[model samples]
Target: DHGSQYVSDVFQDEIAFLGIKSSPSYVREPQGNGIAERFVRTLKENLLWVRHFDTVEELRLALLEFKETYNREWIVGRHGYKTPAQVRKEQTAPVSIAA
Candidate 1:
């Protein structure tokens, strides 16, 4: 999102520090955010909805495990049917932001 909170310098610094890519969809273009939206849906369906955690630490651990499993096993069409780990391993293109 290009919303104020997301675009704020504080938020951007945190994202950069964490080494996560910050790619916001073009304004008013929901289609551009499809991948992220799909990820949230998948997370809820595969983990959140089906599991219960008694504590935040337990949930965090579960999420960490889920991330590893997802990156290693999930085949995504957008990545040409490759798991995220595969795609990342093959990635060599330079990163850029579009205006």
Candidate 2:
């Protein structure tokens, strides 16, 4: 999806400040882009917007904790109301087939 945030003047200016050359463009799959945009929104909502970290280390620690909590507890309907950890476990679990 073509989210306004990526192309917003403020966002562009922020990236430019960090020496990043960001360009917004269309992708072949519109649906996939929405996933990325939604993730950015979720990350901002859950972690960035709510917390004020004093240092990069503090931010890193918080992000790690957030990731763990998200994967272990956040239930997604697409995964049949299962947490990401459960889905990953099912995916990687050894498959047994009785002969």
Candidate 3:
């Protein structure tokens, strides 16, 4: 779930230390990485292309704001027009089953 940098010893060691299982993307299959691709496209269109950042810190702050807005406001068509925040709420909500 990372770029070519994941092949580095530091990256591999960090993930191993964190006990995170790495699932490498499929070779020659762009569709397998569609979600990440779409996110990058969205980020570029919404933040990178529209704004000018004088510093890396400024860009980082803008990205955090953009992430919050996207999760709270953006309607995801694939999720029945639910924002990511809504989907997360539903997923984490307690479920009750009555007999």
Which candidate number has the best lDDT? 1
For model 3, the superposed segments whose C-alpha errors exceed 4 Å read 1-8, 14-32
User: Considering lDDT, where higher is better, how would the candidates rank from best to worst?
Assistant: 1, 3, 2
TM-score: model 3 vs. ground truth: 0.74
- lDDT of each residue in 14-97, candidate 2, tens digit only: 999999987555666676667668878989999999999999999999999999999999998878999999999999999999
Kindly report which residue stretches of model 1 are placed more than 4 angstroms away from their true locations once superposed: 9-23, 26-29, 92-99
Scanning candidate 3 in windows of ten residues, the lowest lDDT window is 23-32
TM-score of each: 0.71, 0.68, 0.74
In candidate 1, what are the lDDT values of residues 30-66, reduced to their tens digit? 8767877789999999999999999999999999999
Query: Which digits, one per residue and each the tens of the lDDT, describe model 3 over residues 26-86?
Result: 7776765897789899999988999999999999899999999999999999879999999
Scored by lDDT, model 2 comes in at 0.88
Comparison by lDDT, 1 against 2, better one: 1
lDDT, candidate 3, residue 82?
100
Q: Give me the displacement of residue 4 in model 2, in angstroms.
A: 22
TM-score, ranked from best to worst? 3, 1, 2
